[model samples]
Target: MDFDEYVAARGQALERFAYVLTGDAHRAQDLTQTALLKAYRHWRRVTAAEHPDAYVRRIVTRSYVDWRRRGSSREEPVDVVPDLPEEGASADPAERVAARDELRRALVTLSPKQRAVLVLRDYEGYDDAAIAATLDCAEASVRSHASRGLARLRAVLSEPTVPEELR
Candidate 1:
């Protein structure tokens, strides 16, 4: 497919990947824009790449890691906080909010490499080899990261919950 067509088709998916990486809508947008702009400049080479989408994702992930290393604030800027209530009436909204906040905090605690590996492997549905190729690491490294990342996530998930049983 042509560059324009490819962009139209994959843009949202790319943005979602960035969002998962940064956990902020605005940062995700910025990361997507920066990655896309860089990709556009090297369109010829990127288009010829085996998986251009993966290539762009790598750029986004790398950019986020670099940005974080520069001592930039990780908190997502928000204009207004949404006050949506919990889904089921059986659950207390406050408890749900607390759980969500815990998850977000846990996600932020992960190293950029660990977060990238977990997001790509578990969230993006990528295989070990695909993640290794995208991250330009050995497959064994991917396996190790994914294993450690998942273990950490599981530990976080198992922590005490506001609703007690929700833990």
Candidate 2:
């Protein structure tokens, strides 16, 4: 596909990948924008690759991993806090939403490399060698990151959520 067509088709997916990698929508948007800009500038080389989607995903993943080295801020700027769930909200769907939110929070606690590794492995279904290639790291590093990241997520997710009354 041409550059514009690629962007038009895969743009939302790219943004979602960035969001999962960064755990912040705003940063994800910035990350996607930056990666796509680079990809556009190198369109020929990217499209010439065996798997152009993986190529662009690598750019997004690597960019997220490298953001720390560039000394970017840890916290995002927000205008206001989000509202709590309504009292009458049903339990089943609310529980699912809460579970997803908890998972997202747990993900953000991992180091950038670990987070990227887990997302690519568990979320995106990439194999070890593919993850290594995308992250430009060793296979051993990918395994290490994945193991440590899973352990961390387990620890975080296992913690008890304090009741509103207790808080």
Query: What's the lDDT for residue 17 in model 2?
Result: 92
Model 1, 1-167: lDDT tens digits are 66788789999898988988888888889999999999989998888989888888888878987887787746743222233234573298677877566566667656677888888887888898888877789999988887887777657666443553543
Query: Candidate 2 on 14-86: residue-level lDDT in tens?
Result: 9999988887778889999999999999999999999999999999999998995587745543222233334
Candidate 1, superposed: residue stretches over 4 Å from native: 76-105, 159-167
What lDDT score belongs to each candidate, Candidate 1 first?
0.77, 0.82
Instruction: Give the range of the ten consecutive residues with the poorest summed lDDT in model 1.
Output: 77-86
RMSD value for candidate 2: 5.4
Instruction: Give the winner by lDDT.
Output: 2
Colliding residue pairs in candidate 1: none
TM-score, model 1 to reference? 0.74
